[model samples]
Target: MVTFLLGFTLSVLQPVTGLRGFDTPNDAGGNITLTWESPDSGKVMVEIFRSQSPLEGYQKVESVLSSRREFVDTSAIDGIKYYYYVVSIGEDGKTDRSEILGPVSSAPQWFNTKRWNVLIILILLIIIFFIFIRLAKKGTKTYIRKIPGLEALDDAVGRSTEMGKPILYVPGLWGLTNVTVLASLSILRRVAKKTADYGARILIPNAEPLVMTATQEVVKEAYLEAGRPDLYNERDIFFVTADQFGYAAGCDGIIVRERPGAIFLLGVFAAESLILAETGNSIGAIQIAGTTSTLQLPFFVASCDYTLIGEEMLAAASYLSKEPVMLGSLKGEDFAKIIVSLLIIVGTVLATLGFTRIIELLSTG
Candidate 1:
């Protein structure tokens, strides 16, 4: 009973287990190295756990080598962040865990806010609000900004019309619910108007059925807005298979048969990103792609001509239509970034000086 109790005490202290040598390399394979001195004379195996994100649940990996003093992880994906922890198991089959040490992530982050973060957020909101008000009062050239990617649509549509072919606009997998999806749909509206104006054909191949319906509304509205309602075609903006690869295959088939001059892939995409872009590339179509999903970002960078990363995709929306809300949001985001930058600098200085106040603040407040 006494030995059992000691094991139990060690288990309870998992959150505070004293250890050392925790570091992570976010680039490449997203590996992290964990090493520590086993309590002298303690015959026990160490264990590790990891999670894809902070909010996710932890999962056990494997025990640390008994003879060795280190464990290096190689299973994590590049770009995405992961969390890690260590544990020790005793000879009697008793177990104890160390505190979670790492949350190594390669993906770039905009901010890390705590305590005074709220103040910084408020400052950003105010800045954005005022920018919009100022722009409205001045009747500024902010009337409408032009994104280069969006500007290409007219040329793509005209070329398609001249060749007696259709233009392919893929709103991606995120239906109309995602803000990026909505932005992509807004661009779809412009594409519809341009195609209608030149008497060209436009096809919206949607992976989500819901996007199929939304694209219909967006295209029809664009035609009505352009005073060419007769040019709209319901069959053009239709659903493809929902499976990512299946959708890519169907669209690839369409490209080979119909031969769209330009292909716009906006909003979310995943593993099938390169496949679709390569397909479009093979058929000699001008492709413009944008996405916020970090996992698939590299593929877009490699395959597409214009790839919008991080908040650039958001900025593209305002660039397209000059919406006050988006512009204001951008101002807010900038202030938020400034606040985050200041906090990072201050935190580094404080942490180096061993000031526990901020840690306490993070914990309690």
Candidate 2:
């Protein structure tokens, strides 16, 4: 009886069996996986523990149902050894500990092969862009569709000249950092040149100091290019308040007082877009607007005489410049869009036919 009692006590105090840990494969590192066999005696919960050293400082990392046999430790440090173990707890609070496993270290990989498709696409685009640019430099003709809003620029400027009224340009509420503002500046240069040629006054009121400075420079350059430096007025290009509504109010005041013949509202805008466009409409000003803001497009389209939507705002720079490089880049972008559209159509067809190879290839991990 004494021998049997001793053996039973030993069994009760024994640790859980068959615990194992290994480093996870095909990863950027900092991970280890632990697994264990289920306790045979009864249903129990398993607790996982980890430590930097095998013999000391083991802290519980996770608790899992008895049916689960695996845990992934994502907190492992790269280049540092880690130790782990498991404990099984019975429903009656009896606990058994597993032998610790040690010295697993995470490592980094130089490249992620999963992104190979992305790399191929990037290379192809670069090749296409360069090829088109080269062809353009060799004097290949690139056809661009006519944009009515852009085509109307000269007529707008001519009308302003005929009316003897200043042309008002608002470069939106954003600063120079925005792509839309940059495009606006490019359009501004073209407008300034037209106004200079026709000897008409052009007023550029800015909500940003940097934009004001850029406008002054661009307008002055345009005047000099047109051989009408005398017509360039520094005061006409001035900074207004940066406050959105305040800037709109100030621009409205200018519209009311100056009654510009042509008003160009281009760049990033918010609620102030409707305010400006409606005011321009009320004053009988010939308003031309363009913006990447989808919400503001309807307002411009409703209130302005002409509005350039979405890509037209981006294309304005290339269209107005007519430089070989810009034209080539634009054409390349169109080509890329066509390719992407074709791929989408093909992928859809294949997916409908129960072939998902293309879809899988395009999918990102």
Candidate 3:
């Protein structure tokens, strides 16, 4: 009876109670906050444990002073339910555990409110794009500034015709996946049609086989569209080497032998740009060059008779084709740029005046 009474007294000396855990608020998930009230008995430390389920294995996560009542468990996985309990150790080395507070599962939010500014800006741009497209379809005119390189196409082809020499067009060394190459092809259609109308030969030496096939198709279509299908020659549009300098050397050989009166270099180019440009210059060819490669722009500007810089290369298609949809899209892009500029200026001024609401509103994060 005395032994049983002594065990009962020891159990009463150390006890743990009042444990609770819940999902963290205002979070992207994978977090839980736990809280418990310490027992009336004096304690030294409290240890936290987690388990997938209350009836299964439990792993120690953290240990805190007994005076602390709360802990945040950030290691929990999203969409997983977890159970947590705490063990309190007393000054006398006695230990007790609280009841497992459980079944809390972290969940991720579908949308992040932090990027609201990005969503708003994207929606605005989309609205602008569609608005201009609709306006253009209604026969509304969109004004585009004259691009000199694009405007001189007719004269360039005319010069080739008068000289009775082939017109050389290079679509650069890049593949069909490049936007610059696609733009070059669009311009080629126009150039091919002009050449067909004048009955002048047009030579296109490609660095990629796929681009050569595409160029041939585009040239043939242009000839057909010009009502001169009889003059279209598939042999004139052919593939050269894919090697950068090899293609440049082949083009230089053509410039030396065939001596094309007019050369059009339009697409993505690299170090070989100057090689071809300088060779065409030495051969007295009237070279009109356009590329998105900024590194090669200075060489083209120095060697070619006319150069289309940056956006002008992209604008050449819409300018030459005069398609309302493309023109409208270009106009819309300019309008959006103006809007962004204005917003930046306004935001800057407001920020300097200690009004940060506008700046904060535009921040993506």
Candidate 4:
């Protein structure tokens, strides 16, 4: 009777209470969330334990402050039943355990509801793209801002013709797989057409053999389009060395010897950007340079007469082509960017005014 009374008193003295375990929501499988009422007793540490059975094999999983009411067990295996409990340790090191809570398991959700905002935004953008595509097919013209670098293409070509010197076109150092190289190819077609129109010579030296072959076709097509296919010389579009610095040195030699009246640098470049640009600058060539490399842009801007910055180079093809499909897609994307920017501004204002539900609505997790 005395032992029984002492055990009952200790049970009643336990400070930890109301422990519960459940599958974590909006997550992949293999996780369980444990929650408990915060210990009301003075200064304590809470330890979390897990077990396969309610009565045995319990293992300590985590420890947190008594003020904490929740913990996530990331080690929980999917589809495996587990038991959990909490033990609160007082300042004096006395521990009080809560009743075992169990039979909880983890399973993955097919769709995380927390990412609803991502779904909505994606759907909205798709709808906008389709709308613009339809409008473009109906012959609606989309207005785009002028990029001065592209605007100077004609002047560069005219200058080369008047000076009676060949126009040097460098299709950059990267392979054809790069987007900037592809963009450069598009601009090349326009330059080739102009050169063909004026009966002027054009020289295209490439760093990649594949790019050399592709440039031949692009320039050939441009000349044909300009009704001057007979003047298309495959010899003019040739491959230079693939070695980076060697290619730069080869281009520098061409600039110094041939002294191209106008130099068009439009593609992905690295350290060689300055080398090529500076060489062309020293020759007094009418230089037009563009690239997506931020590190290389300052060099181009400083050395070249015309520099296409960032998206300006990306948008140059569409701007020059005036193809309805390309223009419409470009316009639609610009609108989507504007809408996202406005949403951010509005969300900021609402949050500052203590109305943060707008932010909550857009949260992805």
Candidate 5:
């Protein structure tokens, strides 16, 4: 009877079994997965613990129902060895522990299998880009729609030239790192070329010293390319105060004093968008504005003669230059958008018809 009672007590104490752990797969890797077999006797809550060494420093990581049988320790440090075990608590307040298992370390994978869809789409874009570029290089005709803001550039420069007044160009209040500033620089090159050809003086005021320096180089290069290097003046492309409203005020002063015939406001703008645009408007200067700032777009639209909205400003470099590589890349991205849109629509229809495999594939990827 004693031996039988000892056997029964041991069975009751053993509430969990077969505890094991391994590093998670297909991940950047700072995670370890643990699994255990719950006892068939009844429900129990399992608490997971981890340690750097097998016999010490064990810290409780998580508590889960025995039925779950699995847990992922996301806090596990990559490249470090770890030991883990589980303690199961029964309804009768009895507790039992599973054997420790580990010395396993997490490692990052080179490629994630889950992102296969992204890889395929990336490959597709590259193929499309190359194909379009090849066609363009072979002199095949490709159509790009008219952008009125860009088209009016030459007329604005000519008006300044005919009126015998200087043209003012604001390359945005942002630093050279801003993408809108880069786009503005591309448009600046075009304007510089036009001004050089027309012999109309161009004045560029910058809020960033780096942008001022870059503008000088860009304008000088444009002048050189136009074979009018003599017309390039470094002094005209200068830095104003870094303060937002102060820069706007300085630009306004230039408009009031220099009385430029035309103003080109292209790049990122904030509250100062209206301040500058309205100032130019008061001076009766023909203004063309473009920015990615949605809040300030209305101000530019209301004050400027032409406003290049959002992506139109981004696409201006390719549109104005017509370089085969740039145009090809632009068109390839457009094709990618169309493809993604079509897939979304098709997936929606399939899901509605109870064919969920397509939706599942997309969702998983």
Candidate 6:
């Protein structure tokens, strides 16, 4: 009895860490959702209970819920005044309880206007997105605040230029044909142009022949942009043997021999990430690395001065492009991220208080 009350109170409070709300859809007779954040420790278990009479008698009701936010309580009968509550049960019968969400109406919702409403919402979101795009075009910065990475590129390149050594651009192991590889090549255009302007040479040792080819085009363009096209040399952008370590060894050779001032490890990478980073560290080069590979992230974090983790790699080209599809996508991601975050906060509160039904109700609503 004591365990039930404590669970009930905490479930009502729904105290948690890292939980995010899943998208809410009303089609399921029992709408279910998930929370992104999980407990740092402890196995989280959920249970439901019911009462025809509030305090006197309550019966245990097992509810099927996802490992995430909320679940639909479809063990429900229409026109019946049913009471529902939950418990966050832990080991040894220890549990926290939630407040009842009840006497709920189980009749289908939006047997009303779903079809009509869907089109309206799509149009609204579309309009809102374009409006922001227009504002952006007029030189009106959106209300969102950011500290962009590309803005720092000049600093990275300038530092290298001052050091009187070559700059190393490694596009890692992804094939040249990948979109991200192409994006990385685009960034190299800007970086190369900056290097050329400073009269500092860049060395691009790529793992793929196709990426090597595209990179050559971009670097050539950069030199052209800086009006130093004659200064561009094919030897500066060369293909390294594609074996991971073989490529790493070639990059290492350039770092050691050419003594480059800056080393950029972009696109994709793996175990060689550490080999390259530690080498650059030894050379005292300003190393900035970006890659989408999760496994190698730790090495870049430790060795590189600036590490672009995860999707930041993809966002790099868009940011550099400053075009509508690119910038628009960037802004869209931010808005979606915000919506995702708020839902988490609410779901945690409802689940803690034994009101996970609120997650379902509010999410679907």
TM-scores for every predicted model = 0.62, 0.87, 0.79, 0.78, 0.90, 0.61
1-365 in candidate 5: lDDT tens per residue? 99998867655745577777888988889988887778755346788888999989999999887678788999989999999888888778788788889898898889988878778878988898899888888877878889999999999999989999999999888998899999999999999999999988999999999999999999999999999999888999998899999999999999999999999999989999999999999988899999999999999999999999999999999999999888887877787889989999999999999998986578644
Per-residue alpha-carbon lDDT of candidate 3 for residues 138-174, written as tens digits (9 for 90 to 100): 9987778898898888899999899999999999999
Q: 4 or 6: which has the higher lDDT?
A: 4
- For candidate 4, the 10 contiguous residues with the lowest summed lDDT are 7-16
Model 2 lDDT tens row, 1-365:
99998866654534566777777765888888887777555446888888887888989888887778788988888888888888888767888777878777777766667878888888999889999889889999989999999999999999988998999999988988899999999999999999999999999889999999999999999999999999989999999899999999999999999999999999999999999999999989899999999999999999999999999999998998889899999999999999889989999999999998988898867
Per-residue lDDT of 31 in model 1: 56
Residue 304 lDDT in candidate 2 = 95
lDDT of 6 at 316: 75
| lDDT (C-alpha, whole model) for all candidates | 0.72, 0.89, 0.89, 0.90, 0.90, 0.71
lDDT of 1 at 108: 23
Ranking by TM-score: 5, 2, 3, 4, 1, 6
Best of the two (2, 3) by lDDT: 3
Residue-pair clashes per candidate, as listed?
A: 0, 0, 0, 0, 0, 23
**How good is model 3 by TM-score?**
0.79
Give the clash total for candidate 6: 23
Worst 10 residues of 1 by lDDT: 13-22
lDDT of 3 at 267: 92
Off by over 4 Å in 1: 1-120, 140-147, 353-364
